[model samples]
Target: MIEENRFPVIETDRLNLRQVTKDDAESILAYLSDQDVMKHYGLEPFDSIDDALDEIAWYQAIFEKKTGIRWGITLKEQGRIIGSCGFLNIVSEHRRSEIGFELSKEYWGNGMASEALESVITYGFEQLNLQRVQALIEPPNISSQRLVERKGFIREGLLRNYEFTCGKFDDLLMYSLLKQDYEKMSYST
Candidate 1:
């Protein structure tokens, strides 16, 4: 079972993945409010700080419930959140979870998301002993699709109109990385 007593902090060469705090509301709002960043995020841009606060609260709720963990992505030199990534809907018995992430537009093509995602995935497999890590991506999110593909997540199938967000139902592509697959990847590297 995944531990809920302490939040794990993951660090890479350029980024730190730590718990999201109320103080990060403004930063969270900065990107989450941007239409381009939130385009495939399944929600409308947040217009108020309260919306960001609600998001932080949801992060807390999921952690407390042992259902998910979201880490704020920050630079080691400047510790303000630039984005976030984590696993959600964890099913311990099944050893599976859903992965999600987003970054500020300013940081989009700099490989920050990939760095944070790699750390999160390693924790999910190594610490949580998760057997399967999956991602549900909107078909139009080509960048995200490419990122996960590079990480070895195989496209399972397209879930036609799988989710309803921002007014209408949208198609989502289901992708997964199994433990055996991850093991093979680790060996190849």
Candidate 2:
């Protein structure tokens, strides 16, 4: 189980999904500043490391408010922060949250995202007592869509022109996973 309720450090074979700190700003800026990394990220890429520092403040504020938590993904062997993943929104009364993630370009296609996600998702369901988790992905991000689906999220529907990002309106595909669904998946194994 989780010792610290909010923003618990999660460990896996290749990664550690740990609490985000101001010290990680430089590491996070590497990806957040990359256009390719932020292509479908629903926001403009960070132009400076200060932007990442601001994001670190945002992450800490959200956790302090109990509204959301973002974990910095640490590649243990490499000893550097490679990415981030966590609940983008937490609707406490509804017992659900919106999940989001981003990984450095160098780490893409290596299954590291899945490893970090699995740890956080498990923490959400088992420790946070969340009943459902939802993910919103831009239509063009096939890899992200596949990542969530492989973890048992079912495609709910399409939200046409749901957001304005990167200077244009974009459509998003919605996907969700129920706690019961995850439970079934665990028991089956």
Candidate 3:
């Protein structure tokens, strides 16, 4: 089972990740509504503030149910939300989970995603005792693929017509990182 206290305030030199709240609706909507941001994410671009609110509610419920978690990624320097990242399809019995993330388009290529993802990945391996972490990305999202690969996740395979989003069936490039490998990398770093 996932630890009840899995929801943690994770911090890095330039970022802070915390629980998503209803109060974050506006900031979250900023990116959730952008086509460039939600293109690969399962849901359609959030059409209104209510869409963000509904998703936030869903995010909270999933954590409460011990099924998943979504961290609101905040940029400390600006003191505003710039993105979100977390695990879904978490199966503690199998010691594995799927990871997902998206940042505001304006903040792309700034290394913030790396900072946020590292904190979450470490938390999975160390605190949550997760044995494997996986990322399923749309085949066309080169940046996301590179981000996970840079962190040492290996491309596992491809899932064709894996998800139907944005009015069509989308393919996903599966990436995985094992806890043992992550530990080895951590020690080396």
Candidate 4:
């Protein structure tokens, strides 16, 4: 079990990362239900508002368990939920995990995702003391690939037929960054 103190609220210049709540259902539905956002994510668009509500409930349960950390990303200025970001598929024994994120289309191309990811990566390394973090990008997600690369995650290689999305198997590009590498880069900067 993760210690409660281990997970603290994190904020970046333009974003606030906090625990998700049932009240976030509408905001979650705003982005999650968009077909554009769901295209490369390997999941169907939310069928109804109830689906988003159920997801928020699941997120709340996970939060209480202290196993996986998820956050609802809100714009600092507007105080609106633009998307979600967090550590998914956590494996404590390995001191490693996969990071995932999604933002509303309106917020894309504005560097919000990159900024949020940088903050999360720093948190994973500095606060969580994790050894490594990984991200799997779908083949066609060039924007996401660039975002991870800018954050110092190296593209390891491709995992062919790695995920089933939109009724077909999709290739995924694996990327990872190590705590040691992050430390070195930060020290240099």
- Highest TM-score, which number? 1
Candidate order (lDDT): 1, 3, 2, 4
> What's model 3's lDDT at 74?
91
lDDT of 2 by residue, 1-189 (tens): 223554677888888788878778889898899999998887799989899999999889878778788889998876678898998678888989999999999999889999888888888898888999999998789999999999999999999999887778899999999998988775222
lDDT of 1 at 161: 89
| Candidate 1 lDDT over residue span 1-189, tens digit each | 467678888989999999999999999999999999999999999999999999999999999999999999999999999999998999989999999999999999989998899888888888989999999999889999999999899999999989889899999999999988887775222
Local accuracy of candidate 4 as per-residue lDDT tens digits, 44-153: 99988898988788677666665567788998877678888878766778888788899999989898888788788887777667888999999789888988887888
Better of 2 and 3 by TM-score: 3
Top-lDDT candidate index: 1
Model 1, poorest ten-residue lDDT window? 180-189
Clashing pairs in 4: none
Provide the RMSD of all predictions against the true structure, rounded to 1 decimal.
1.4, 2.3, 1.6, 2.2
Which pairs clash (backbone N, Cα, C closer than 3 Å) in model 3? none
Model 4 misplaced stretches (Cα beyond 4 Å)? 5-7, 186-189
Quality of model 3 by C-alpha lDDT? 0.87
lDDT of each: 0.93, 0.86, 0.87, 0.81
In candidate 4 the C-alpha lDDT for residue 177 amounts to 90
Which is the winner by TM-score between candidate 2 and candidate 4?
2
Regarding lDDT, does 3 or 4 come out ahead?
3
